[model samples]
Target chain A: MRTLFAAISGGLFGTGLMLSGMTDTRKVQGWLDVFGNWDPTLAFVMGGAILPMAVAWALTRDRSPLLGGSFPAAPDPRLGHNLVVGSVLFGMGWGLVGLCPGPAMASLSYGGPSVWIFTLAMLGGMLLAPGVRTRLDVMASAA
Target chain B: MPMDWIYGLAGGLLIGLAAAVFLLANGRIMGASGIIGGLVDGTGRSNAAERLAFLGGLVGVPMVIALLMGFVPDGAVTANPLLLGAAGLLVGVGTRLANGCTSGHGVCGISRLSLRGIVATCFYIAAGGLTVVLFRHVLGVI
Candidate 1:
């Protein structure tokens, strides 16, 4: 039951991404290209997304969600160095290629060479995450 | 160009619905990077079946939709393989390091009114905007 719901949710999310023009790297890039011909499509997408999600958050409060697992606690609010630096790095990459993981993975079937290369490298990077975290931990300890 | 507001809204709604379902039914955040990242880094072993199912649907449904509806992404992608690879590396590493991405932080986090989500979103969007200015406007390399 959990897996079925997960698959359904994933499918809907992918469909939404494709429908919202998010799958197009050009559209995403245009949104980021503020000085250039900025397209406001993404704004609509964001607004549309927030509506129902906001409702869900409100309704789910004070009750156990339908699935059995406990609701995830609110994320830590600390404005730490890792969060800042990591986000900037993510943004730079997003700006450069205009392909985040969601769209990149969704469009993989037809993304050809470029998408394939990006996906492979992205996986390689994920694989290296432990090492990076270990190094960060070491630095913190030394400091 | 007319901003396809209708499509955007419809798509966005569907996305929200999906997130809501994942939250309501599974009690999990629908973060793509986190979902996939956890699988790779071994933090998600307990939920491997669920994660795999979600990914299977994520990748599979899009392919089916593309075939049935003839929908293809309208954006042009980078032609240079090296640049594409580098960008991919950054996104993968950064999302994992930060522990969220557009869907997780931008959608779920913000809806819950989490400060970290809002701040992270602001930082990344600003950084992305600045990068475009540098690369597209100043350098003209992209």
Candidate 2:
């Protein structure tokens, strides 16, 4: 049952990637074009998604997430160095290869080899998470 | 381009299943980024069942789709492998610093109606948007 639901979610996300042309690195790259020959489609897609989600979050700060979980959903918006640093890292990658997890997984339906490389690297990143967290914790404590 | 509803349904199920299972069994959200980050951040995994299971579906489904549907990726794909790996790593690191991914914050957290989640999601969308502009437009990687 759990697997079923997760599959559905991934399917929806993957489908979105496909429909939006996110699976195509070139499309993503094209959207990345800002000033010259900027394809504003991606911005519109993102904006279309963000507003509703933002409103929902603002309204539901006190409520538990629909899915049962250990932690109550609460606003923990990071406005410090973390946000900028993380965003920069994320943007850097998004700009470079045009495949984030959501889209990368979606692209696999298309079966591109580059997507495979990304998937492996992403898994590697997941694997390295513990040590990084510890280091971050130590640094925060020291600071 | 119109998205196929069949795929949407499938994706939705995967996402929902991952979320429900992770939330119930592991007491975690089934955000791949967060799960991966937790592995890195030195914290004992609060729950791994749903995370692993959901992640598995994420990859497995694509292969299955290709097998079952005879889906072939477009022939024009020519991305640099090294760059792709770098992007993945950056995303992982970003998840670590942000404490959640788009799935976690954008979908689950926002659904729960948290302000911070909203902020996080905003940052995510904004970064992603600006990134397209900068790399694709300003720098022109190719």
Candidate 3:
């Protein structure tokens, strides 16, 4: 049941990405290109997505998931160096290639070899992040 | 308003609905990076099947749709191997480090008014725009 729901969710998410033109790298870059030919389509997409999710969050406040596990706990409000630095790096990648993780995966079928190369490199980076994070934490503590 | 805006909004709604379903049914945040990243890093070994199932659906559904529709989904990415690889690496490390990406932070976190999410989103978007200025306008590399 959990797996089924997951697949369904994933499918919907992917379909959404394709429909919203997010799977297109140029569109993504257009959106980020504020100075160039700025495309506001992504803004609509973001706003549209937020409305439903905000309602979902509200609904979760008073009840548990229909499934056995608990809903995700509230995120910490504190700002951290990891959050800021990591996001900047992620943004640079997004601006460069116009693909985030979700779109990257969604585009794999039609994205051809370029997508594969990017995905593999991304996986390699993911594998390396933990060690880097640990080192950063150590350095911060020592400082 | 261009038709693309409508498509984008409709698609965004569906994406949100997907996240809602995942949260309500599975009790997990629908974070693409965290889900796949967990598997990559071995932190999600306990629920690897679920993660794979989610990913399979994410990749499979779109492929199947494109096949049936007889139209390719718009997936134009940079052909530059060096740029693609570097971008991929940065996205991978950055998302893992931040513990979220567009879906996780931009959608889910922001919806819930998560401070970390909002802040991260702001930083990333700002950084992305700046990077674009540098790469596209200043350097002419991308």
Better of 1 and 2 by DockQ: 1
Which one wins by TM-score: 2 or 3?
Answer: 3
Task: Pick the DockQ winner.
Answer: 3
Native contact fraction (fnat) of model 3: 0.87
Ranking by TM-score: 3, 1, 2
Q: Weakest 10 consecutive residues, lDDT, candidate 1 chain A?
A: A77-86
Evaluated at residue A36, the lDDT of candidate 3 is 96
Model 1 lDDT, residue A70, Cα: 82
lDDT leader: 3
Better of 1 and 2 by lDDT: 1
Q: Which stretches of candidate 1 lie over 4 Å from their true place?
A: A140-143, B71-75
Instruction: Please tell me the TM-score of chain B in candidate 3 relative to the true structure's chain B.
Output: 0.95
lDDT per residue for candidate 3 within A1-143, as digits (tens), equals: 99999999999999999999898888889989989999999998999899999999999987999878788988998888788888999999888988899999997888778888889989998999998889878877888
Ranking by lDDT: 3, 1, 2
lDDT of 2 by residue, A22-106 (tens): 4666656666655545454554444434444444434434544455443443456446656555655666666677666666766
lDDT of 2 by residue, B58-85 (tens): 6666656657877777754556777778
Q: What are the runs in model 3 whose C-alpha is more than 4 Å off?
A: B72-75
**Candidate with better TM-score, 1 vs 3:** 3
